[model samples]
Target: MAQSTRRRFLLAGAAAAGALVVGWGALPPRQRLNTAVPLALDGGAVALNGWVALAADNTVTVVVPRAEMGQGVHTALPMLVAEELDMPLARVRIAAAPPDKIYANIAAIRDALPFHPDDTGNTQAFARWTLAKVARELGISLTGGSTSVKDAWLPMREAGAAARGMLVAAAARAWGVAPDGIRTADGELFHDASGRRATYGSFAAAAASENPGDAILKEPHAFRLIGRAVPRRDARTRVDGTARFGIDARPEGMVYAALRMAPALGATIAGTNAAGVLRLPGVLSVIDISNAFSWRLAGHDGAPAGVAVVARTFWQAKTAAEAHAIRWDAGPHAELSSDGIHDDLRAALDGTEHHVYFAQGDVADAQAHGRTIDAEYSAPFLAHAAMEPVNCTAQVADGKVRLWLSTQAPSIAIGIAAAVAGVDREQVELHEHLLGGGFGRRLEGDMVAQAVAIARECRGLPVQMIWTREQDLRHDAYRPAAVARLAATLDAAGTIKSWDFIGAGGALTDHFLRRNLGLPGAGPDKTTVEGAYDMQYAIPHQRIAHAAVASAVPLGNWRSVGHSFNAFFKESFIDEVAHAAGKDPVAFRRAMLLGHPRHVAVLDAAVRAAGTPPAGRAHGVALHHSFGAIVAQVAEVSVHDGAIRVHRVVCAIDCGLAVNPGHVAQQMESAVAFGLTAALEGAITVAGGAVQQSNFGDYPVLRMGQVPHVDTVIVLSGEPPEGVGEPGVPPVAPAVANAVFRLTGQRLRSLPLRLA
Candidate 1:
């Protein structure tokens, strides 16, 4: 009997080993690093792997895949190549790359998996696996979520280093010395032992034939351009008004188009009185808008059905469009209102089937373990309100589709344009342009798809469709409104023993899957519940859960997404807990963040930067980590005439390393303004299922006078750089709100902190 059991065990072990081997083989290999190869050269210039090009004049052009949406990605990404290639940053130029899998954004997509930052169980593992499979198979290229730098960090460096090595090898072979004897700097290679020197451009042709075997990247101490405040490559063009945004593009024979989308998602045009306007002016024809909802296929953003009026000029199109009155079907969502959605979300707080995104220790007995504190917080829906608005130029003819636009995801836009124009994906040509601003709005390609659909009806004529500012604001896929019910238990000694959090809102991922993938997205969404649940506060017993309630309102990522509101929710509650514990807010937080050195470092730095605020002025501090970055902020504020005014903010960030200290500082200031707008007056209301805000007059951002003086301190480290754009956005609001609570004695839990 013993021998039989032993034989069974041995067989089971062998079977497990065989399965492991098969699974490893089935897994997709990592993206190829040496995918770069020299392309055909012309005019004594050598092109390498669609990234680097060396001209005989010693000029370097780096092909950048990410979009330049005022985030300095175009300037920052090429800096990576310049640093590794030992070339001057001023000499490195940028060129847009073609839509190809080799340049896909593999990091951003995988980072969006439906798993909390603290999640480590099978659910998290499965989410990662699914995300990897999708990213590897689809090759999604996006430039949002503050991922452009992190995504291109290694690839850009490797491209430059490898190219430089090839050039050095060519020089070494000519000098009759080892490759190590050849040193390169500022586009010139020298062999000290042989007393031979030549510009990289002089050996461009021979270098293309030489092999780039392996490259040794420079150490942190060797970095010259990095960590320095380098000037933006396009600074001259922007100030000179030569920067071409989507609104500036003009294709040959392209006529103008103006459109008014249905007021709400699912609504349709019942009829249009275009005959009267068609004969009035330069108006040509009215085109009905309809396309496959396979791209950005969610809510109101999925190629919304509308009517486009094409004319000779934009003014003519707008005038003619205004003259025509269209009747809308006003679908089932016509009865939906902001108040109604809020009520539904609040009702979901009492739901029984909560999708527990994170759990630790004994949360079921949290109330019994300590004194309980409970609070409810809410935030309103928001619009993107980008300065450039939404515009697309499209022409579909001869089984080909062409578009010119500023989009965060050009590859996605290409696929969407192709699908709508009834052409093969390979037949699509995209002219990527710069955006005035994105704020997550330009990430969708629905506007491009809509333009293509309009052009499809035309007689192969190029058409440029521009949404009126009112239309852009009203039709935007605004950020979802949400509410959270939080409960924390503190022991007799004032230490937090347990925490329970519940949030309800429209799920971005679920909405995306339902519309785009045609699947039942059943589970917790990381975006909706991220900042609320994934906090670093030390608690023995904790459970964070989110309940999803569907709404007709359109939703997309708004800057920090969940962190925007979750910070206000969690950080405000911490202030309340601190007061309840009879402890100072900063000291109370410092106690909870004992074991977290990185968090403590930023918190201490912010406090020191703040120095000593005025005796009567109230100071509030909040620390949060998001997108692989940690941030702490101290807001000094005052109230006058019932208005809360933030005078100054001391900010500290540890985003691994400051790739560009100037850019990092600028981002901090930008985020402060962006976040302050939300804290002061960033809200979108729905009435009868239509967005009530039409333009900036109704949806205002922070003006120059209202902008607070932001003092930024970057925490230096040898660690690899993390996200920079969005991490600065999350902590600003909470820091301001906490200060307001101290001044007013009323815990303003909701956004747009109102005072009476």
Candidate 2:
């Protein structure tokens, strides 16, 4: 058995490496090259060596792997690295990591599966297998689906701890003292007994010389910095306007470009008359950006065909572009609308035979002998709708192109820019600027290629291509709309006997994976159907299936990915089952989760924090475990003046060890606000093949006035730390919906719940 296991392990490792090679090869050749030096020292005196660097003045620098779009990962992730390094919070700085496979998220790996994480008997083995498959498929390690923090929880902490160990070893070697005798605090190593002390800066050179070996990490009980609350490292800079976002980047001799794409998806620019627009004030040039190569070569249909108006300033280009007369070949999707898409999905669900994703026991027999309940739910398409719109600035000079932008996929960006400019990837320099927000839209590198194309046409002059708020809204690759049908059976004692879920939506995984593998036909997209089919409840029988339907609108990942819509469908249906069984929502969930103490603890904490009656606020509780964390949220809501006002929210999270209590709390608060906004008024509808909502005024985000008083409670389970960024998102929608149900006695089947 042992020999067989070893052989299997070796085979798996070999396969993983092979997949990595194929995935990398599938990307544009430009992305495979590297240019930036492994080590860099900034004017802030901060050092960046690979993924981490420390300042001569004692500040620590950490390279973040994911984009920050209100999830507060910029603050939360640095906190994790700093805690493990035992550094003071004020001395830590953050930088976005370059694209590489080392940063690919493991949660997204599991998400690609047709099964749930808990359903596997050996989660570790399953994870390894899934990761190998992902490496073979995605090619580059990119961040999406809120998996950044969770995926990096271990590797990042170990990197920090290893660095700290090296510093301690260097200090011990210098002081001629036992390693145990040396006490390290902030950035200094000291020996009080011998009166010997040294700052990390003094030993950094020697420490850098010594290779970090396999050092034993500190146990959770011995950690002083991991669980404590510390203020955000970037908070002051962000508040003081010192933080430089993508829009803030300006190069010498930089000109601006504004764009207008065909309103309908899959449309192409046939021709454009730039004479009248070129005569406008500040109009420098007009360039057509059609045929810009796709950065995501995997599963991409074609280039992001569009036209660019170059001007001296953003407003000038915008005015000129608006005045320019452009003709478009509105492709097959010109007649598509939201209602039409909904009908298509409904037909697919009803008529098409879906791929069997998961099956356990005989669901037919269980349903045959028990009381059955059936329900259908739907969610509209959604936009990432980041505060800062989509934009990229590129300068191509002397056969070299430099890009400064807030992009989730820098590696892909370099490759796309290189392809467009007809240069080697190594010749392109990517200055990854801080993103105002990047749920997943930035993951697509079309804008980077567009900017590069414009810059190439302008004799290597720097060109800043800015997408106006209107364009950003109208042209985003939206989260696909979905329809779910759930059926559950209960026994005589009211226990759930069987569960079945069927989903129909556009396939995100199939598009990317099939394109990379050179597969011809459409395959089952597991992401659209996995969440509802893979319920965590201990039902005796369960079956899940999914059918992928073609859609004209471009689809991509959103904040919780499948869970954003699936959680609502599954949890809300579970609540409906509880109502059918004549039990309270909290009680029903607790009864179902008899053996899971971690999930139970969070649910209990959330309910208790919500308080009892006399407050006149009804409470609704939702518990979901995703991206390695188990989170429970209790929402208190009341209806007044024909409006549903969420008054208070209590959240309890168990994300293994609390790397930074303050950051965790902040993330939970941010999640509540973000999720609440989506639940209240976040939707992107299509009419006449064009996006209807243009900006915040039409597609409203949650404002400060609408935010509830949030109470965050962290549950420290001596387990390994999970994810902090996205686990908080899934529970918020269901919790709020449940609370609304309590207040109005009306169950909202869809999102953006209307009160009157």
Candidate achieving the largest TM-score: 1
In order, what lDDT does every prediction score? Answer: 0.81, 0.75
Candidate 2 lowest-lDDT run of ten: 1-10
lDDT of 1 by residue, 158-242 (tens): 8888889888888888878998888888889988886888998888778878777766788889998888888778889999999
Query: How much is the lDDT of residue 14 in candidate 2?
Result: 55
lDDT of 2 by residue, 113-193 (tens): 444556446745644664555553454556666566666676677777777888888888887888888877887888999
TM-score of each: 0.94, 0.89
Predicted candidate 2: what Cα RMSD to the true structure?
5.1
Clashing pairs in 2: none
Local error of candidate 1 at 374, Å?
Answer: 0.5
Largest lDDT belongs to which candidate? 1
